[model samples]
Target: MSRTVAMVIMGAFTLYFLIPIWWLLVAGSKDTGSILTTNPLWFADFQLFQNIGDLFAYRDGVYLEWLRNSVLYAGVGGAVATLLAGMCGYALAKYRFRGREMIFNVVLGGVLVPATALALPLFLIFSEVQLTNTFWAVFLPSIVSPFGVYLTRIFAASSVSDELLEAARLDGAGEVRTFFTVSIRLMAPALITVFLFQFVTIWNNFFLPLIMLRDESLFPVTYGLYAWNTQLNQLPELRSLVLIGALVSIVPLIVAFLSLQRFWRSGLAAGAVK
Candidate 1:
């Protein structure tokens, strides 16, 4: 009875979350007329392709620009963040230095600081340096992920053994060379884990972009969708476009997670064993 109840509860939660995603699909396939008249959960005519066509054509293909910007910000930012975090984490784990624990504690403290709280200050700082409304405003901040650092630290401590470092040293491998060749290869799973986490975070980021960017051309998909949503009151046509845009924005993230899912699972399993 207990197991049955637990399974049923889990299924209910899954359905609860999935229903909104299902509605986005159904809504995107619908014209405004069908959206107002037909059942919300049921499929309308298969106009998904038409909706996409209209979406790209609208506002001189602004949606595509938003998608491109998001890809740039998330992809490059995630990669850089992953590398920095991995290097810093490896250093913290492998080396005994003064203030190492303090640095670790500071990273932990950063995890507790909400990103939203920093938005206004970051904007002001960027504005002072004339970086606001530019790609750097969004991209620079996204690369600093405290949680990624935290994950890399934990993973490095357990997965990377000191004996291996000693062996590498004995073989006359310089520290930088050893880190790149041996340590990084050993830390592949952790690095992938950090990359995916930072990728998703950067991809889904809204508030930072919303604050820093004023130009429509620089908007990421999340902020772009929000702009469309706000303008829907004046431009009723944007309602359907927003729905379709929401669906479109979700695809890359889903693809990313699906492609790297095995790495995530294996990384967690490796952590558990270590």
Candidate 2:
């Protein structure tokens, strides 16, 4: 039947996506010698802990530094981006102000423009201001998420009721007070979604850091791994380290998703009921 065909297609797509992760898991479990010699899709040995220790110990624990940078960029940037997006979206949805539609339209246009396209101009602007090669070069840009604003606006327009705002206002609550104590709770799911999206985007960002940061210590994990990848010819031992670092880098993202998925499911259910 059609339902059977749908399930088959879904299974196919699932395997297609999961096969690489499985390979990475299998490969990360093996010693460097076994990786090329053994079956890539299955475990060769239980060397996962050993590989992790080697990865952490290499270069006096520079991998840990890169991991910390990634956490700082993604965690702080995602949180700030989510807060800004929520406030902008909530204002657009609730308040009737002049130029609001124009501003929303501008944000929509920004959503259409790819981040890659802005890198060059941003580089030039940052260079002029002498901000390149610093953490701000990446972190400042990461905090501006046009898509987050657009998504939050759409969610707020429907999910947040005007009556609730009226009640809050009548209760002697100020605008900022109402938003933090009232509207923010109602929009938790959307904000979390925005945070996850921005987090992943900032975490995986490579080109901007490659272009901006000349210092190795400032490199995020993605850029640091790429730097190692490029030097594989010089330091062949880095091959195993790069693989292990990559596998380790994704752990935070997985953790974030697993922790916040409940909010997403509840949001979906609430939307369905409405």
How well does candidate 2 match the true structure, expressed as C-alpha RMSD? 1.7
Estimate the overall C-alpha local distance difference test score of candidate 1.
Answer: 0.91
lDDT for each residue of candidate 2 in 1-274, tens digit (9 for 90 to 100): 9999999999999999889888888888888788899888888778999999999999899999999999999999999999999999999999999999999999999999998899999999999999999999999999999988887888888888999999999999999999999999888988888898899999999999989999999999999999999998998888888888899999998999899888767654554454
Ten contiguous residues minimizing lDDT sum, candidate 2: 265-274
Model 1: per-residue lDDT, tens digit, 1-274? 9999999999999999899999999999998768778899999687999999999999799999999999999999999999999999889888999999999999999999999999999989998999999999999998898877777778889878899999999999999999999889888998898889899999999999888889999999999999989987798888889999999999998999899999988876776675
Would you list the C-alpha lDDT of every candidate in the order shown? 0.91, 0.91
Clashing pairs in 1: none
Q: What is the C-alpha RMSD of each candidate to the true structure, in Å?
A: 1.4, 1.7
RMSD of 1: 1.4
In angstroms, give how far residue 45 of model 1 lies from its true place: 1.8
